[model samples]
Target: MSGAVMDEIVMDGLRIDGCTVAFGGLRAIDNVTLDIPGGTITALIGPNGSGKSTFVNMVSGQIPPVAGRVVLKGQPITGLRPDRIVHRGLARTYQVPKVPKELTIQEVISVPLLYARSDRPLPSGVRSAADLAHYCGLRPAVTTRCGQLSVSDLRRLEIARALACRPEVLLLDESMAGLSLEDTDQVIGLVREIHVLGVTVVVIEHVMRIIARLCQHAIVLNQGRLLAEGAPQRVLTDPDVREAYLGKGFTL
Candidate 1:
């Protein structure tokens, strides 16, 4: 990363300071700290069991940190409830979307808006639940039940619902996992569209190509601590990052 770009990313956005999470006796996240620039796409990557999901969980308030703090847009948000965090302009999707199977797409999208306590209005061009669905590329009948949707469509619905919260930051936890190349490309396009709408996006993905294409900045974690962070092309090439996450001799 250029020093100029690094300076930009270090500006106020999302800040994690010495954050840690533990389950039983094992530390899932071990004093990791980093910054996610506002209005930019970032990739969080690591090998399995390297605290990637656990880091997102802590940021989105699904799991409380045992130490340190999380701040978004300069507001401290450590240990808040998930809904409370959403109300504070941060929302996230899961690796496996977990919507009520029986709920119609329209109904599912409406849930967040109904409970939205954030002062921030919905992003421009999205005025209704249907509009949100369309923005997310869900062109099926608004009445379609989530249960009947394809895996890709389900992922779209999950993102649309998160958008309903009018978040300033949206964390996508492997939104492209298990998708075909075409489906992954569609998601990559969707993420670009979302970024165009001015929301900061943090993507957790194992697909290095997607990360290379989608993120300007990449943060790598290994064994629950930050291993490397910088421009994607540069960070992915670091020997330590390669051996720890991408494996030796891997080429991006």
Candidate 2:
């Protein structure tokens, strides 16, 4: 899909309104509300316990929100099954890439491609499992078993699987966690490519440099609540956001 076509297709991407998730009396996400505009890259950043992963989980249907609505393209999808959510044009990857160690990379990517059904067609250039694998930079290792791949390759495979779902919105949870600088750059480039295909991307990352380089907008959460949001450079320099990460007297 061309960027211009994607822009015309996606208007209101995803919205979270008064969403809350609690675990045994403790709220991981507390009535937080946010909007992720379609066809744009947005960063979801925060301190360790700021509920970044929890928020993604809630939106992707891994966990049900105790109180709130998750709307995608004007339809409510708060408590749907994960697969249902995927079919609804939303998909996500995990902080840890979980795959069957015995499965080849192609096999893993094929699972979603074979089953995913969406109103929108698969992005241009991604028609088969091999094409998806190549798009994710895992073509050289296409036949390799998941357990035999490096961390970077595993991450790429996870992303390929998500792309197979043909999601209008893709949430990447800490996809670059343990990669080397060079590997990180490659993954960043891959993300940019995905965005160009017209997927609205929500990335959860701690690396400020990556967020600044890749995202047009940034949202910060502190203790399960929104602390700051705006352009990357401005949000990173917000007083509250700085304090949330580096105590009360430091700036990033």
Q: Which candidate ranks first by lDDT, i.e. highest?
A: 1
Cα RMSD of predicted structure 1: 2.5
Candidate 1 regions off by >4 Å?
1-11, 246-252
Compose the digit string of candidate 2's lDDT tens values, residues 161-221. Answer: 9998889899999999999999899999999988998889999999999999999989999
Model 1 lDDT tens row, 5-80:
7666555479999999999889999998899888889999999999999998999999989999998877899989
TM-score of each: 0.93, 0.93
TM-score of 2: 0.93
- The C-alpha RMSD in Å for every predicted model, in order, reads 2.5, 3.8
lDDT of each: 0.90, 0.89
Question: What TM-score does candidate 1 get on C-alpha atoms?
Answer: 0.93
Clashing pairs in 2: none
